[model samples]
Target: MHFQYCPHCGKKAERKQIGDEGLIPYCTQCEVPLWDMFTTSIIAAVVNECGEIALLRQNYVSQTNHVCVAGIMKLGESAEETVIREVGEELGLKVKSVEFVKSYPYEKKEMLMLGFRAVAEKADFVLSGEVDAAEWVKLEDAPGLLREGSIAWQLVRAVKVIFDDHTLCSQFLRDYVDLPYMKGIRPEDIEDVSEQYVTLFAEERNSDRVKRVHVGGGSAPFFLVSLIEHKTAPDYNVCMQVFRYMVYIWETYEKEAESIQKGMAKREDFLYPPILPIIYYEGAKSWNVPRDFRSRIREGSIFEKYLPNFEYYLVPLRDYSNEMLMEKKDEISLVMMINKLQTAEDIVNFRQLPGKEIEEILKDSPEHLVNIIANVLRAFLLKMNVPVPETERLTDKVREKKMGELFENMEKMDIQAERRNTALEEQRADEANVRANEAEKQAAEERNRAEKEKKRADIAEENSIKLLVELCQDLGASMDAAMQSLRDKKDMTMEEAQKKVEIYWKEPTDIPEKKNSPNG
Candidate 1:
């Protein structure tokens, strides 16, 4: 069952033709069923009293690749029991408490993963033969270190959520202990992992006013780790700004690489990690933002080729449904749903939220829930100068229907506002176009003047050359000697070289020679 070849006879597997299951793989020589079985394993994000999560690097995985404590589940052991045993065996650390986080069906190794979150009283670590080293990463920093989107990576995300805010952690775990990403693999594998996953280096570039977010992960010697955040709404000028951010990151890495190349670094290490830009947008209207920089330029323009031609992964979250969200129910999806509720024309459209969306809300902290509810209410009353009601308004679960009236009223106001704003925006756009045209015209005129001046200069130089040639013929002197005599006798400037030709053109005459006595 561990491998394709029979353990008994070392013969390859063949299709066993029987039963409703189509072509079950089996070893004919040993007469045993391979049955497409996968190894069952347990992985845990162990947290210590200091609120730091435990991570380890295995002998197989490179030093840079760190993961949570993980190992095979021995026969006849519950997934929960395995979590305790594995932590003790692999890290020599005792887990006081362990909670099931999620499960994942790993296709790469053909293993079934049961994820857990464990807590310990101490921060000490004694790594085993399987683990090369262990690090206790702070909960906030754990997401940044985890291999983004990997099973271990995803588990750490769920565990860290509880560490960040304990109130909602249990409630969230109760409903979403089995994450949606692990569907059909196991009944207990589901979770959300967006908190602290983004590690931004260019902190100064973005201000607090801008709600910037990044989510990304990748592997190995030539690994690429990009800090990507989700952005919503359509911003026409956002492309150039986003491109600039990417350039800054690339340039930073390039500078580091250059240092290593030039022996400026103390170590002989060299690495240039790739960056990927991801845009996750969910707004009321469709994205009017240009997909590529070229799309913004006027069609058939001569300068099109000279303009920027870069592209990014634009995930239009508005296009997906809550059902789709169930399969990937996490912070990003929740954000998208919140945006959708703000946009729906009909209150019934709010039901587009996945069936278990309530569970998602209950799983988060009360403060978090309050914020979401408050935001929704505020989005509805954006036109009004309203003093937002206190958080207690969300106490009644039945208020969803009552909130429908508010949503409907907001839709009516939004429609009128949308029309007015659209017209005004169109007028402004036309004005901008007119100004651009005028500026272009001025630039063209300046270029035309410069071209004419250059032409005049060219003609003058040609005429002067012809005149000098004729002067040389009349003087019956070599051109070089005549020019040299003018410079040496009168100290003629190089600019007036042609002037000397003019003087030479006069009839050749013998003049009285005077000796320079006092001055010489």
Candidate 2:
């Protein structure tokens, strides 16, 4: 009868008797031919003191009796970690510095066995529930105890070769030792902005006597005054008060004043009460005043604008002598001029002086006041030291051009940085591609080697079987019985078969000839 069914679909069908015995059916759904399958396992070769190696006897399965302490490598664990962990759990002892030994294919299953030699620090021979018993047997004797043609025997042979090489032992130690203090960020790269500011500035208790107010709502005025003072004298605190007062006046005038006249009229309304009352009492000069009134100046108040020009207003105090000018000048004359010049400059620069009031003050002022005013004007102009109004527009255009150049340079820098990064990325990708290609080539070579080895092994097995069958037939034995006997003997090969055949055919003792020894 011939049977019809789809193995891939798991569907049954009507059966028919088949003529040929060798014909096999393929799965309809997957179009795959049926084949045998097997699984892979890992084994560990654990060596201890007394020159003995530890081996495990499995509770179940035939070949399991010939295995070493081993288990399946769990997810997220390495082969070495698995071996160490398994040894501790199965033997109730700690394993140190596990090493990889060798791997090979066995029967239908592939075995990657690791051989670890640790000085059995402490061990309690408590048989694990899964293992019948554990034993520490001598290296040479291990082969006899272990099941023939098993992974355990393979592991023993690998360990013997590894232990004999002292260079291999040194390399193993170099790979596993933990070196001291190898990692962290460097100290100099750390930044603390807040601490930097605190360290740079000098700290002092600020008093409410004459608090300075800034015009632009920042510490910029303080920064400017500090910079200027720092250049002049290292310990110049006197200018601090002067700059504070100037800032206060500028800010007050900007906030409250409409023009020079109105600002002067409302001078008493200034927030700083002391300076406001003193400045208000020292009233400005009037144009309609009598000649006698202009001639007789007050002790503190001086009509500075009544002078000939701005430069004359800045005359030093030493020029006005006590003896020569006492009859003509009051003792307070120099002080009053200093105060007037300072106040006038402050008010004028702040745009607090009205146009009509300035013109009238100029017309009515005396010669001395005019001279001082001229000097003060010159000092103010020199202090500014700016280009003329027409030249300033050209200077601004030049500044804008320089700024554009700076921006262009900055953009170029950004472009160069981006290009460098792109180049670096391309280099990394090229390196990765090269590495991937090398790995693939190496893998292909390894696969080719394995296939070659497998083909050689199959040929050897076939050769052994054919030679044994022929020898058995010559000896007048049945083909089926010979094949069964060959299959039953593990590790049977063509070499072993030939040896047995020769030994069986040898005559009983026609005294064998001895070879000439080296000593003889």
Candidate 3:
């Protein structure tokens, strides 16, 4: 067994066991166990007088010959203290102050390394035994020399922070987080944190001042109210407050002011005064009004006659330049008015072009131009009640003329198609008649050839029968008997029998001479 000291508590730890692998230790004094004991180090990114950085060469197996500077933190020493002490001992250079940059967790040895920026008061090369060599290198070339996961890379990032513009960071924090938080709170109630900008509006004739109120509770119910005095009429002072409240309610609730200003605009109506303006003043917090008739009167005014004139008080802020506003004016105006309407039925809806038409439009337009058009159309369509997919405003007569032209083209196409089909049908009928005539001519020629062949066969048969009858007559047979024999024995026709009789007569038999005299 071997003994060790606890790095955290600095107490002698008893070695519980030792094996072929390693020794396991537990501290009896601190009542804690340490596993995988490792050393932690701090790396300083020291910049010299010439705006150059300091680097050290490594020789260990983990990182060989690559440049990095790191030293183990001594017991009971803070991370910053270790960096200052390490730079002095390693390079023999004095540093003025160490700025803590960041800490990175290294998994290889279960260690957390801290990186810091140290500015050198003076440069004196005094290399320690641990570092083979040290040199000042340019900041740009530092990344190439330093190994990944080394302290050198972290130092490069910290220096980049120093060189980066500060305004971008301020703007980023304000837009994403700070502005949203400030806007979330009621303007009058915001004086708790933003007291420098709050102000009171007083009556010109009387010293009595007006108040700003935050009514309702929870997330959805709250609103900000500002009171103002009537310029000429003293009795109408409360009425003026009602008017100001109407404006404030709409500006805050009805209008999507931020999105509209950003050029990606939308509109939504509120149950209370929908559109409210951002009022700028200084040093006023919380608003109060008469508890009895004034509050009831304000409520009644909102529900009764106040709804119709709400849009008249709504004013669009002129923060955007005229050119930008003109570019987005139709979209912004369309959205603003659509939201102001009591219901979707109040606004007129236009027929929208189909997707194919929209795609053709996009293909013809430039990328940026198309995107702006699409965004504007989308914002308008969102507020409208009807399913107007994509529509742009044009003169009514022009739209009607375009529709008429489209119908005319369709009618012409249909007529041309019908004429082409009729011509094709006529051609098909002519072809069919030609084929039928050729078939009939072939049949007639085949019938005539067959009749000629039958006539030639009849002539050959007559010659054969005559020769047989002549042979019989030469043997002294009677002509009449020979004819009757050929007819009966050979089944010959009458014309064949008569030819046989004539052939037998040429043989000069007694019966043949009597037959010729009687027949003549």
Candidate 4:
């Protein structure tokens, strides 16, 4: 920038030319150097367990389809931390692990771009406001979505190299274990554990995955992690069924443990290891089921408090977002928030052009997330009584920049139609009142016109008295009769009235008959 005045001292600045630097401005009153400053930013390729690459669509920067998650590095933060924070802030996904890929000079923004590859456990995400859309694209489809030679593409290519090599894949997967959810569990402990540590009874299905988890550096125990989508009413039998599973796990594990103990494995010498059962519930409603075995016993029975209990950890998705899940930062929490709102219009708004209230939920949401929202909106519209366009039409409208105009027009038209439907009587009454007022005005105008003509006749008759008297004498009629004839035929002029009188001039019958014998 070329500054004409110094900000430090209120004095005019002068341009001083240096050897290679083009005319630099300086303040003569106080020494001040003017230089252009640019932002330092980071970009990265974040991948999930399935090897799908995550791409982000920026709010203001890119006019294209999508870009990798990027942001300015905060002061004193390392490039790796910046990448991890950017992914978490924008997409709401915790980066399990991250590795530096490369760096480049971004000429357009005049900033340095540090690239990295981050791995996340949960592929599902919530988006922030700065990101318009996001998507997880496979390596084959990335070419069309990513701008060639850009830092985002360069980082993604590096991630692809790491995925291709088998040795690197195992090493990275082992290193990238998520510690946030699995507290105190290290990558080395998993290596020491073995799979299929539990065998099921004949009636019980033995196909599911079972692992040996060592807790507190103690003897390894066989654990069964079951995901249950339970929806039925909770009963006393539910607890007993869990107890039955525990019995099977213990009975089956003891047989396997003895063989391993006989083989003299260095792991554990115990004859029977404990079988810990974990039940993860995925239900729409909250978990209000009995937690203690005693709760399922007879309420008033004397032995109710003494019964043995079998309880397991229950994790339900519905409980967290019921009240304060509006943070929009938690992926499942945001979904629960929407379910809490349960309004079609809100779903449309949250999916398309989401605002500040639910900021973090949509900051990093992908276009596919929008598609799911669209489906939800469509389902709600189908159930609503108001007029709604076809699903395809609505989808097309929401996908473009003209959605605001289309929504406004739809609301306006709906309001107008509703008014027209409900106010027919009022409109008709108003029209009839206007027409009656107009008819009364026309009648009053006609009466005024008649009076005006009478007045004009009085003036014309007064002005024509001399002519009328002469004409009456010529026509052999009384002046009153001649005047009566003129008044009766008011459409004629004075002369025409006299001519008409000459045609009807007859001595009044009411007057005494005049004798005509003298003239004979």
Candidate 3 per-residue lDDT over residues 1-520, each given as its tens digit: 1237887788877766555646578787776666664567877788653446788774652455445457778889877677768888888887654555567777556777777666674465798887777888755446557764355664553442211112212221222222343233332331111111111111111211112222233344333232211122123244344555444434543455454564322524424523222221111222132222233455656565544442111122222222332333222222222222222232221122232332332344333232233333333332232222222222121223232122221111233344567668769977987888788889888888888888888788767677778767777777777888789867978788877677545744366444556658
Candidate 2 lDDT over residue span 302-372, tens digit each: 66456321100011222333232223232123222322433323323223323233333334434333333
What are the clash counts of all predictions, listed in order?
10, 29, 15, 9
Error of 1 at 498 (Å): 81
In model 1, where is the ten-residue run with the lowest total lDDT?
Answer: 207-216
Q: Write the per-residue lDDT of candidate 4 for residues 1-520, one digit (tens) a residue.
A: 3467787786887887755887888776787665555678888788765557788877597787578888998999876678778898999998765655568787567888877666676567799988888888764345457775467765654442322222222222232222233345433433211122222321232212233454456665435334232222344455655666666656566656557666543355445555444443435455677676666667625786566655665544445434344442433343334333334444444444333444444456454443333333333333332344453465454334223232333332243444565467568877998898899999999999999999999888655654654566687777567766676645566667666556545544586877889768
RMSD of 1: 27.5
The lDDT of model 4 is 0.55
Q: Give the alpha-carbon lDDT of every model.
A: 0.55, 0.42, 0.46, 0.55
TM-score of 2: 0.25
TM-score comparison, 1 vs 4, better candidate: 1
TM-score-superior candidate, 2 or 3: 3
Q: Candidate 2: lDDT over CA atoms?
A: 0.42
Q: Show where candidate 2 strays beyond 4 Å.
A: 1-38, 59-66, 108-122, 161-520
Clashes of 2: 29
Error of 1 at 81 (Å): 3.2
